[model samples]
Target: MSPYHHGDLRRAILTAALDVIATDGPSALSLRDLARRAGVSHAAPAHHFRDRTGLLTAIAAEGHGLLAEELAGTTDLRDAGARYVRFARQHPAHFQVMFTPNLLHTDDLELTTARALSGAALTDALAPTAPTGDDPHARYARLAVWSLAHGFATLLLGHNLDRLLGDEDPEEVLRELPMFLLPPA
Candidate 1:
């Protein structure tokens, strides 16, 4: 860590990269371009991120942290699935790159930590509310919640919701997923 400048260049570069990747696609990102945009020397980013992969990985990690925070804020585990979709909608930049493994280098420490915490938060968030059942039943129930939220977000992002809903609100569909998936009363 050079103290003269770039004291925290790693974070700066990641922020800049996420912005660029969000506005344009990942293919449009590059160290030189990021440095130029960040007003640092072209070599500055390398000192922190090494390459595009490192920067992308950092962004993904950051995304997971944000998701964890969002999930942590939910008071009702039963409603968290809908909140997950809302999180993705609000943080489209982070949300877009987070699920794409090809876009990130998984070996990065920050990325790994971020992913782990998100998983932990999910388990914590659901533990109290998960239906009482046998092992397979519990696993399937958890998967159903995760998948429904994930699928709804993917559809909303793909604009499929628009084609399906016309002018009506599709968010309601997201909110109702848990009710539909939970074992019938």
Candidate 2:
């Protein structure tokens, strides 16, 4: 591959990797292929990312950071849930890599910090409506909220919701789902 001399090589490689992942799944990603796509030498990606695991870790961290941004400043759990769904739909490649722990270096500091930020954002969103207590019930409530949003996003991304949501807006469905699934507090 021709060496890429200008612009941000790291960002270019990451963008190329995301495009590959978006079209062919993460399993299809490779430094050589990304380098070719970025018009850089095969060693370029390795120089910036070290290896495939490192690349995936970077993607995961970036995804969490993006998710945190999307979930930020939202006090309503339903709104946060809808934002989560929108983020998944908008960045399916990052979403896919972020959730697949096997593809990441789970202990990477950046990944851990980004994940913590996103987790905190989600927890904060649920704090307003969640039962006030440092008890198992409160923790379960948080888990349930996360599960509902995550499950819905997963189903939507997998296209499994098409049959159930046919011609209906998924975000609208999500906004109304908790009303039927959870008991009023």
Candidate 3:
């Protein structure tokens, strides 16, 4: 590979890594394989990502950024929840790594910042529906919103809900579920 490829190596490595993860799952990912796919020297990926944890951490950070965009400026909880599922479906590889903290450098500053941004967006989006005060209802609503969105995203990504969902689109099912579970405002 040309040394000139270094200018684009970071993006190339991330794209290749995402492809590998999407095709064979995260366990199959290797810096050597990513370097090969990116047509760079084996050491090139390491230059950008010190190791696999570093690489996964970068991917997770990107995932959170995308998630924040999806959840931003939402006026409804169901809308935000649906956007969360959409983000997961659209970027399954990133989604998988984003939630699996053990596979990433959780202490990485960029990853932590991205995660906090996404969390803040979700909190803001849910604030309208969340009841005020220290009541169990407020706590339950907050927990339920996160659990329902994350659980559905996890299930959809794993195909664990296929038998339960039948021919229906999973996103549609998710959008409808919160409506029934949460009190309408």
lDDT of each: 0.74, 0.87, 0.86
Q: Which is superior by TM-score, 2 or 3?
A: 2
TM-score of 3: 0.90
RMSD, every candidate, angstroms: 3.5, 2.0, 2.1
Model 3, span 44-117: residue lDDT tens: 88878999889999999999999999899986887788888999999999999998989989999999999999
Q: lDDT order of candidates, best first?
A: 2, 3, 1
The model with the greatest TM-score is 2
Q: Residue-wise lDDT of candidate 1 within 1-185, one digit each (tens)?
A: 23336556676777777788668867788999878767778888877776887777777888899889888855554457766887788777788888889988877788999999887777666676675555786677678778878888888877878877687655556554446554322
| Of candidates 2 and 1, the better by TM-score | 2
Q: After TM-score superposition, what is the CA distance of residue 131 in candidate 1 from its true location, in Å?
A: 4.9
- lDDT value for candidate 3? 0.86
TM-scores, all candidates, are: 0.82, 0.93, 0.90
Candidate 2 structure quality by residue, lDDT tens digits, 1-185: 46748488899888988998998999999898888878888787887898999999999999999999999998587788889999999999999999999999999999999999998998788787777668787788888878898899999999999999999989878888855434333
